[model samples]
Target: MAPIRTFIAAPSNLGLKPPAPGVAPGVRHLPEHLQQFSFASRAGAVQTIYLEPPTYHGDIDPETRMRNADAIRGYSIVLAEQVQDTVRAGRQAIVLGGDCSILLGCMLGLRSQGNYGLFFLDGHTDYMWPEHSATGGVAGMDLALVTGNGHEKLTDIHHCRPYVPEQQVFCCGNRVPDESYVQLIRQSQINYYDLDALRRFGLPATAVQFLQLVETRGLDGFWVHLDVDVLHNDLMPCVDSPQPGGLSYAELRSVLLPLLSAPACKGIDITILDPTLDPDGRYASVFVDHLTGILQDAATAVL
Candidate 1:
């Protein structure tokens, strides 16, 4: 049977660049917005824990060369501790994020337990070095940081560099192209499948392939990183950076359901849903519906 689901809300926008000077990104409210729609109840969450994030700062930290780097680093450690505690108790964590950077904390926590694989589903690869990043926001460079591509500060947390091995990761659903970071990810050992690749190989098949890899490698488990922008911009336009093409609700369900059904799947983090863009809550409501439905369906299938 699937383990009990525990929702951890780490609503810190320190990973993202502010829209303007001294203005915090509205993405920080992601957890609260989803909870307003009763996401935890609908997803059958047994417990809900909210981590208090550090204050957001707009200035770039000289040491890390990333905006709000200091705050983000501290928050990631705190977030990691909570994730470790949740997993140690034998619960499946469904982390509600402030941005993609929270992936660091999730992975760091998993690294402490043992080696784990990653299913990184996003519209952009998010694998850029600090020098290549235009905004210097850790959100854009999360995948890189987690893979030990950046400075020691963020990557060497707990003296564990490369939280999850590059070879153990499966980066899927990236639609953006013709970028330096895209090239970077392609050169890495991570199994990369772009939007076209997903269509060519088939979504469900691709997920199964990752699962087989995890089993054969004898990983402790795997984590799922679901950035909401992976959904078609028409369907999920409330994200920070929306592009032309992405997955639809049904398409996402087809892929995510299989990953979530696996006993080896440790946790999944949902990120980048900006509530400010959906004032009437139409998009957020549908998002909640589809997500909760997928989680429920996965549980049933495993049973």
Candidate 2:
């Protein structure tokens, strides 16, 4: 069995300021700019590396925001280089994200070894490219960028055309997706388990179905991207984008437990927690507890 080598790649600049007021004071000392989880307790099972994003205060012009986006992309490039080195040494990579856009670097790291499948869990379909995104947030364009459909610097990371192909990618728990993004998803042939469909078929069953698909494809392995926004905003209110009718915390645990128990799964990225919104660390504490359990279970299975 191999050790679970978890790397904490924190992309702090990509986080949106907490919508709720008066919470920023609590998180002023955290270097990553977010109060995600403390890796101190899991220190034995993981090798943590904390990578910082370029500094950017959210109050800026669109041009400045775009420049900040470029800086983030650069940070991700450096992250990719480091991750490539880690994987080359036969370790699994777990990226603790500042935002979903960090997927670009993780995918590049995995792609350097060989192509891998992706299991994207989010409240929205992040398929919008630069041309299609109305908000122009790089996080919205990340999935498209990784699959070779967005901005040049992002798509061209790690000397690869795209990190993963459309057929090999699957998105689950999307309740709200832009119409144009839906059209792109349809044309690209990416598998999607929309919120309605997931509800209709319970999460455990859906996990089984998805695992069957992976088995059928004979994929190298699949990376799991767990965006906290996939959970109901009541349970996870700290994200940049909060959507209604998302999965319950228990439902998320159900889905992840089985997936992590499987040996074929490789790597994970947990994203979208903005601690500034969590006034008393309530949301962050719940998320951290769940994640700690997931990592522990996965490590135990391997051991």
- Candidate with top TM-score is 1
Q: What is the lDDT of residue 235 in candidate 1?
A: 93
Tell me the TM-score of each prediction against the true structure: 0.98, 0.85
User: lDDT tens string, model 1, 30-77?
Assistant: 998988899998887999999988888777888888887777778889
**Which stretch of 10 consecutive residues in model 2 shows the poorest summed lDDT?**
22-31
TM-score of 2: 0.85
- Cα lDDT of model 2 by residue, 1-303, tens digit: 534575665655453443344332222223243334565355223576778676654332354233246666687787777677766765667777677777888888778877678888988778876567555566677777788886566788656968988888878888885565578776777787888887788888877777777789877667788888899888887777777768877888788877766666767777777656776777776767776677677666641
lDDT of each: 0.90, 0.69
Consecutive 10-residue window with the lowest summed lDDT within model 1: 294-303
Top candidate when judged by lDDT against the true structure: 1
